[model samples]
Target: MRDTLRTRVRLVGATMAVSIALLVAVESALAHEEYVVDGERDVAVGEFLAESLTDPFVVGPLLAGAVLVLVGIAGYLVVPPVERDVGAFRAAMGEYRSYVPWLLRISFGIPLIGAGFGGYFISPAVHVQARLLQVALGFLLLFGFATRVVALLTLGCYLIGVVVRPILLLQLEFVGGMLAIALIGSGRPSADHVLQRVAGTPGTLYGRLDIVHDRARVFQERIREYRTLVPTIVRLGLGSTFVSLGLGQKILRPGIGLAVVDKYELTTVVPASPELWVLGAGLAEIGLGLALVGGFFTRASAASAIGVFSLTLFALPDDPVLAHVGLFGLASVLLITGSGPYAIDRRLEPVETEEPADAVPEAA
Candidate 1:
C-alpha cells in the first residue's frame, strides 16, 4: 500500500513537472491569430459558417466525436474508482493546497507585466498602451503587497477596456486569474507574508511603521472562508475563453484560421487538409473547454490545456510567447486546485462512512 501510494505521488509530481517544462519550452510559438493575420482579408462570416457547416466531411467527424465524448462520460459515471487509490491521490494533492495562492500570483503577475511592456491592454491583440497602470499592478501582485487590491484593479482595467474594445474579450482568462488571486491573496514567500510577520511581531521596526497591516489582516480574514471558490472561478473564466477562441476565431472566422495554418504550413506537421485541421482544432478546443466549464475530469482538462498551449507554441513559430505566459500559469493553477466546489468531480466522489472499531480489517 505504501509503495503504491509513493508511486502515485511520484507520477503526479512528474506530470506537473513535465507540464511546466512544456509551457516554458514552447515560448517561440505563442502569439494568437489576431496579432498576425489581417482582419480585412477575412472571408464574410455568413459565407464561412454556411460552407463549413454544410460540409459532410466536417459535420460527420464532429458528430462522431461528440457521440464518443458522451459515451465516455456515461462510462465514467457508471464505473467507480478504487477507494484506496482515490484516497491516496487526494492525500498527495492535499499537501500542495497552500501553494495555490502563490501559483495564482505568478500566473497573473508575469503576463500582466508582459502585456504592459508589450504595449497591450490586458490582451496581446488589443494594442493600446496602459503600460504604467499594468506594470504597477503586475509588480504589486508579484510582490504580494496589497494583492487583493491589485487583483481588483487588474479586473477593473480589463473590464473598462472591454467596454472600449470588445476584442479584448479574447483574453478573458485574465478575469479568472484576477478573481482567484483576489480570493487566495499572496501565499508564503511574498512581501505580504513578510510584512504581516513583522507587523505582528513585538518591538519590530517594521511593525511600528506598518499602518495598514491591521486593516489588511482584517480584510484577509473576512475573505478567507470564500477561498474555496477560486477553482470554480478559474474553470469558468478559462473555459469561456477557450470556447470563444474555438468558435469565434476558428469556426466563425475560418479565413483567419486558414491564414494561420497556411502561414505556418501546419498541414505538413499533421498531413491533413487545411479545412480538417481548422475544424479539428476548433472542435478539440470546444471539447476541452466544455469539460473544464463542467468541472468533469478537471485536472486532466487542465493538463490537456497546458499540452495544447505548448503544442501551439511548437507549431506556430511566430506566436508571441509573452501573450500565453498567463494562460500557462492559469492552467497550472487548475492542475493544483482540481475541481473545487460545485464540480461534477465533487458529486462523483464516493461517500465514506465510519466503521465500528471492532470491525475486522480485510487483507489487501
Candidate 2:
C-alpha cells in the first residue's frame, strides 16, 4: 500500500512536470510573437552596451553565485539540528532550503498571492474568481497547509487561466514546479508537519497532504534524492523552448526571421550578412534543440544552447533579453549535469539485468 501511494505520487509529479514544460513552450511562442525589436539595431553600440549592462550581463553566473553564497551561509549558520529556525530565522532558513522541493512552492506561492491580491484590489477587470482563490493558495502554500490539495488545485487554476491566456499552456517549467510540489509535498516545517505529528500515523491525511512521512521531523534528510529533478526540468524547459523558437520563428517563418535579422547593425562587428546569420542560427537551434529533446549528446547540446542563447541575448531587445536570461540558466544546468535520469542518454546506457529466478545463476 505504501509503495502504491508512492507510485501514485510520482505519477502525479511526472504529469505535472511535463505539463509545465509544455506551458513554457506555449507561453514563449506567444511572448515571442509580441517581440518588436532587434536589440542591436540602429541604436548606437554604446547605447546597446549601456542597456545590456543594466540587464545583468551574466544572469546565470551571478544568480548562481548568490545561491552558492546562500548555501554556504546555510551550511555554516543555519546548519540545521534545531527548531528556532522558524520565526526570526525564517528568511534565512528559506535560503538554506532554497534549492529543495519546498523552495519551488514558496517561490511560486508568493507570486500567486501577490497576483491574487493585486487582481482583487487593483485589476477591476480580470478573472475575479481565480484571483480570489489565488490569495488563499498563497496562504496555504506559505503555511504548507493541505499542500497536495493546493498543488492539484493550483494546476487546475493554471489550466483554467490557460483558457484565457492559452499561451501559458506553453510554460512547461511552471508545470514542472507544480508537479514537484505535488510529488514531493512541502518538505518539513509547516502546518502539515505539525498536524502529522499530532496524528502520529503513517498514512494520508486530508486527502493527500501526506501526514505519515514524519511531519514532526522539522528538517528533511535525503536532500540528495531530489537532485535529478532540477536537471529534468532544465532539459524540458530548454529543449521545448528551442524547439518552439527554432521551428516557429526561424525554420517555418524564415521571412519573419529575416525581417528581424535585417534590423541588426552589427555588420562591422560580424562579417556575415545578418539575414544569412539568422538562417544559419535557426538551423543550428533546431538541430541542438532536437538533441536536447531526444536526450542525445545532452551535455553538448546544453552547452551549445548556453552560447547560442547568450548571443541571441545580444541580438534581441529588452523583453527577450530577460526571457533569454532565464533560458541561459536552464541551459547552464543541463550543461553541467547532462540530461539526468529521465533522458534517453541514461536509458540507452547498458545495465546488467538480474538473472531469472528459475534459471541457474551464472558464474562470475
Candidate 3:
C-alpha cells in the first residue's frame, strides 16, 4: 500500500512536469509562427487557444496528456496492496525534507540577480550603486547554497537593513537553489521500505491512519521539494519559447531583426549603424538559447540573457503584446531557474582532497 502510494506520487509529479514542459513547447512553436509572419505580432489568449486546438499542434499537447495518463495508470497497476514499514518510511521522508527550501532559494535568487544587472546596464550612472549591491547579493546567495554560513548571515542582515526590500523576490531564488541542492544531495526514499510498509498494513483504522499520515508526509515533502523548482521550470519553459522564436526569425528571415525593430518603431532614434547591433543581439540570443538548453554556467548565462532581453523590452516597449509578454517571460525564467538538470554545474563538484602519490615510505 505504501509502495503504491509512493509510486502514485512519483507518477503524478513526473506527469505534471512533463505536461507543463509540453505546454511550454506548444506555446513556443506558436510564438515562432507569429514571429515569422509578422515580426511585431501580438497574440491574444483566445486566439492562441483556438489555434492550438487545431490539427498538428494539437497533437503535441494530446501526446503529453496521454503520457501523463499512462504513467498514472502504470503507477496504479504497479503499486502493491500491503502495509509498509514505518521506521524506514520515516527515514525515507527525512531524506528529502531539506530539498524544498533550497529549490525556493534558486528560483528567487536568479531573478534578483538579473533585475540588478538589468537595472545596472539600463542606466549605469543611476543604478551603479544598486547594481553593485545586487551583484553582491547574487554572490552571497550562491555562497549560501554551497553551505557558507557567513554568506547566509550576510544575506539575512542585508534583508533586514534594506528599508524597501524586495524580500519575496530574493527569497524565491534562495529557496529554489537550496531545495534543488537538498534534493540532489539526498536522493529518493528507499523503495524497499515503502514496499514493506504497504505489505504490512491491513484495512483497520490504525492501518489506514498510518497509510494516510505516511502519504501526507511524503506528499508534503515532495511538494516542498518541487514547489520552488516548479516556478523556475515554468520560467524556463516560457523563456525558451520566446528566445527560440526570436532566434527563428533571424534564422528564417535573414534581416528579421531590422525588420522587426522598424515594424515595431522600436528606435525613435535609430543608430546610424544598426545592422551590427541587430546581428549581435540575434547571435547573443542564439548563444543564450544554447547555454540555457545545455545548462552551462547557468546563473551567469541566464543573467546575461536577461540583461539582453530586458534591454530589448525597453527598446521596443510599445511593441505587440506577445513581444513584451515573451520578453518578460524569458527574463522571469532566467531570474527564477538559473540552470536546471542540463546545467554543467552539476558535473563541476569541487575536489575535496587529492589522493596521495603511489610512493612507499622509505626506511622508517
Candidate 4:
C-alpha cells in the first residue's frame, strides 16, 4: 500500500513537470499572430498547407500527444480527486462570489483606459482611437457608477466599432465582460452601493435628492432572475472569440500566421517547423474554444485559457496587453464560477443537489 501511494505521488509530479515543459515550449507559437505579423506571406499557400498538414514529424507527435492527454483526462474523470478536498475548494472559491462585479470592472476598465490614451481602438492592431468616449466609459465602469448602463454603453460602442472596422471582432471578449457586468450589477465597494445605502438612509442629504434610486433598484430586482445566465453568456462570447481567432485568423489565413512565425523566428524557440507552429497554435486555440463552448471540463478549460493569455503576453511583449485584458478577466470569472447551467460537465459528473459553490450568486 505504501509503495503504491509513493508511486502515485511520483507519477503525479512527473506529469506536472512534463505538462509545464510542453506549455513553455509552445508558448511563443501560441501567441496571437496578428499582433506581430505584417500579413505579407513569404510562403505560398499550397506549400505551407502541405508542409504543415502532411509532415510526419509534426503529425505523429501531435496525434500521439493528444491521445496521451485524452487518456490521462479519462483516467482523472474515472477517479476524481478526494470529494472532501474538492468541497473545501469549492467553498473557498464561493466566498468570493460577491466580488465578481469588481473583478470584471477592473479587468475591462484598465484596458479601455489604456486604449484611450494609447491612441488605438480596443486592439493594438486597430489604430483608430476614440479617446474621450472610451475614457469616459472606462472611468464610469471603474467607479461603479451606473455600472449596468455604462456596461451597455460600452457594448454599444464596441458593436459600432465592429461595424466600422471588422478587425475589432478580435476583442470579442469585451462583449462578454460587458454583458456580465450588466447582468451582475456593481457589488460592494462601488459608487452604486454607496449611493444605494445613502438613498435608503432616512436623513441623508443625497438620499433626499436621489430621484432615480428607486427606479434603478426596481430594475435591478427585475433582472436579477436572469442573472444566472452570466456564465453561459460569458462562455459563448469568449468561446466564439477564440474560434474566430483560431479559424479565421490562423487556420483559414495560414499565410499570415506563417508570416508571423517566420518574422518572430518562433521555430527556433520550439524547434518545430514554422508550418507546424502555425498549425499547432491554431488547432490548440480551436480546441480550447470548443471546450469552453461545450462546457466540457469547463473549469480546466477556463484555467487553460488564462494560462494561454499569460503565455502570449510573455512570448510577445509587443502583443497588446490591453486587448487581452477582457479575455483574461472573463476566463477568471469562469475559473471562479465553474460550469453554470447547460454544461456537459453536469451530465458527466454527478449533478450536485445544489449548484456548485462557485456558481455566480445573485449580486448583493
Candidate 5:
C-alpha cells in the first residue's frame, strides 16, 4: 500500500512539473513577443486577451476539470462487484490534490520571469515596472508552494519599490497581483492527510486515540527541542527585510525604495532637505533584519517587519496592481510561517524522552 501511494505521488509530481513547464513556455513566448515588435504591443494584447478568453483561462481549466471527471469514471469502472472500495479512489484524489501547489508555482513563476526579462529590455520606465511585477509574481508563486521565506523577500522588494515611488500605474499593478494570489491561495488541501499518515492506521476509535496521543507527544517534544529556535527565525526575517530597505532608502528616495512611489512625480517622500524619515525607516529595517538573522526576539521582529510592509501598502496606494498584490501576499506568509525549518528553533530543541515515565517509572 505504501509503495502504491508513493508511486502515485511520484506520477502526480512529474505531471505537475510538466504542466508548469508548458505554462512557463507560453508566458516566456509572450514576454519575448513584447520585445520583438514595435507596433506588436497592441496586436499582442488583443491576441492575449482573445486567447485568455478561449484557452487556458477558460478552456484549459475546463480540460483539467474534464480530466478529473474521467478519473472519477475510471475509479467507478475499477470498483469490484461487491461494495466499491474507495481506497484507490481516495489515493488518486489525494495525488491530484498534492499536485496543485506545484502547478500553481509553475503557473506564476514562468510569466514573472518572462515579465522581468521583458522589463529589463524595454525602456527604463517599462523596466522598472516589469521588475516590480516580477517581484510580485515571484512571491505569489513561492507562497503558492508554501515557501514563506522566499515569498517575504520578494514582497519586501515590491513594498520598497512602492515606498520609493507612489503612482497610479503601480497602484493598478498591486491590485491585479493581489487578485491573482487570492485566486491561488483559496484552494489549499486540508491537514487531515498529515494526521492520517502520522497515525499509521485508518479510522478507528482506538487508532484515533493512539494518533492523538502520539501527536501530543510529538508536539511537546518539538516545542522543547526548538523553543529558542522559533524566535530566531522571526528575528532573521525581520533583520533581512529592514536592512535591504534601509540601504535602498539611504541611497535612493523613500519613493525609490518603493516602486509605485516613484511611478508618478519624482519627488522623495521626505521633503527637499536631509530626508530624515527615509534614513530612519532604513535604519529600523536594518536593525529588524539583523535581529531576525541573529535569532533574537524572532516573532516580534517578524511581526514588526510585516507591519512595516503592510503600512507601505497604504502609503503607496497608487503603486501598480501587481506590486501591491505581491507585497500583501508576501507579508501574509511571513506573518503566518515566520522563518521555517532552518532557523535557530530547530537547533535548540531538547532531546527526545525514550519512553513515557509511567511506562518505566523507577520501582519504589
Candidate 6:
C-alpha cells in the first residue's frame, strides 16, 4: 500500500472534492436558520437573532469539519494505485511551456489572501461570528496549511455570505479558484511544497506507504495527457452558454432582445429597426459561441465575449449586473489562456507523437 506522488495527489484531490460536496450539502441544509423564538414558534428573523444559536445552525461548522477529517483519512487510504512519474509530468509541463495554470493559481490566490485579511480585520468591529470564521480560515489558506480543508471552509463561509447578502453570490468566482487550489495544492511558493520536501517526497515514505512508485508514475503521465482537455471544457461551456442565450433570444426571449434595441432607442443612432438589430445581435452571439466552443480563434472570441458581457452589464440593472461580473472574470481568464492544449488550435500544429517525460497533469 505504498503511495506514489501520483497516488497522493489523486487521493488528496478526491478527498477535497468529496469534502466540498458534503459542505455544500450541509450549507444547503442550514441555508436559512430559523428559530423557535417562543415554544413551537417559527421566525425567519427576530429581534434577538437567536437562529444562529440553535442546535442545527450551531453544529454546521462542526459537522463540516468532522466530515472533512473523515474524508481526508478515507482519501489517503483509497487512492487508486497508478503507474506514473510525478516529476515526469512536471518536466513535461515545463517543457511544453504551459505555465498559465500555475499563473492562474498564483494570481487568484494572492488577491484572495489580501481580501481574506481585509475581511478578517474589518470583521471584529462588528462582533460578528462570521468575520471571526473568515479570519481563522483566511490564515489557514494564507499559509496553505491543510489547504483543502481550509478552502472548503472558506467556500462554506462565502456561501453563508451569499445568503446574508445575495449580492455576494458573484464572489463565488473567487470561491471557485479557492476550490481549485484546495484540490490541486497551493502550486509552489506555498507550505505544501516545503512539507513535501521535508517528508522526503518520492523516497523516504515509499517503503512505509507500500506504494509502487514506478507504476504510479506511468498512470500519472496518462492523466497528464488527458488533463489538457479540462480548459477546453471550460471554454466550450462559455461558448455554449452564449449560444443558448442567443438562441433563446430568437425563440424563448425574443421580446427581451428587441427591448434592448427599443429601450435604448437605437433605431436612429444605429440606423436599424429593433427587429433587425435583435437578429444581428443574436447572430453575433451565436458566432462568438461557435468560435469559443470550437476553440477556434480563441483569443478573439474570448475578447469579444469580454466586450459583449461588459456592454451588457451597463444595460442591466444592479442585481443582474452583480451576477454578470463573474462572467466577465471568466472571459478575462479565457482571453489570457486561449484555446489551451486540447483545442482546434492543436490540430494545426506539426504532428507531435513523442510524449515528453516532463509532462505534468493540469491542476484539478
TM-score of each: 0.80, 0.50, 0.36, 0.85, 0.33, 0.45
Residue 46 Cα positional deviation in candidate 5, in Å, after optimal superposition:
51
Whole-model lDDT values for every prediction: 0.71, 0.52, 0.40, 0.74, 0.38, 0.47
- Name the candidate, 1 or 5, with the larger TM-score value: 1
Relative to the true structure, candidate 6 reaches a TM of: 0.45
Tens digit of per-residue lDDT, candidate 5, span 31-93: 211111122212233443344345444444445655875685456447533323433433333
User: Model 6, poorest ten-residue lDDT window?
Assistant: 32-41
Please write out the lDDT profile of model 3 over residues 1-364, one tens digit for every residue: 6875575457436534542343333323322223222453343434433444454444454556558756854564377332255224434533433332333333334444664666631111123335666556555444332322323443353334222332122122232233223322211132222433454467655545454445534544454433324333433443343344444444333345556656655455654233433444545565565555555545456566667656755666543322233234334444433343324545542321111111111000
Give the better candidate number (2 or 5) by TM-score. 2
Question: Rank order by lDDT, top first?
Answer: 4, 1, 2, 6, 3, 5
| Candidate 4 structure quality by residue, lDDT tens digits, 70-148 | 9978887888766688667667766776677889998899899999999988778678767998888889888989888
Q: What's the residue-level lDDT of 243 in candidate 3?
A: 48
Ranking by TM-score: 4, 1, 2, 6, 3, 5
Candidate 2: global Cα-lDDT? 0.52
In candidate 1 the C-alpha lDDT for residue 351 amounts to 59
Whose TM-score is higher: candidate 1's or candidate 6's?
1
Give the TM-score (vs. native) of candidate 1: 0.80
Prediction-by-prediction clash tally: 3, 16, 41, 0, 58, 23
* Model 5 TM: 0.33
Error of 2 at 332 (Å): 5.8
Off by over 4 Å in 5: 1-241, 251-274, 324-327, 340-364
Please give, for residues 1-364, the per-residue lDDT of candidate 2 as tens digits: 6875575457536654554445344424443333544332234334433443355433334456558746854664445444353323433422343234345556557666765765531111233445668788878877888776787888777666555654443233445455546645665566775665555555536425644445323323332234335555556556665776665555544545555656655554666554445445565666677677667757657777878766766666543343233355455545444565556767644341212211211000
What's the residue-level lDDT of 87 in candidate 2? 27
Off by over 4 Å in 2: 1-33, 36-151, 188-234, 264-269, 306-310, 320-338, 347-364
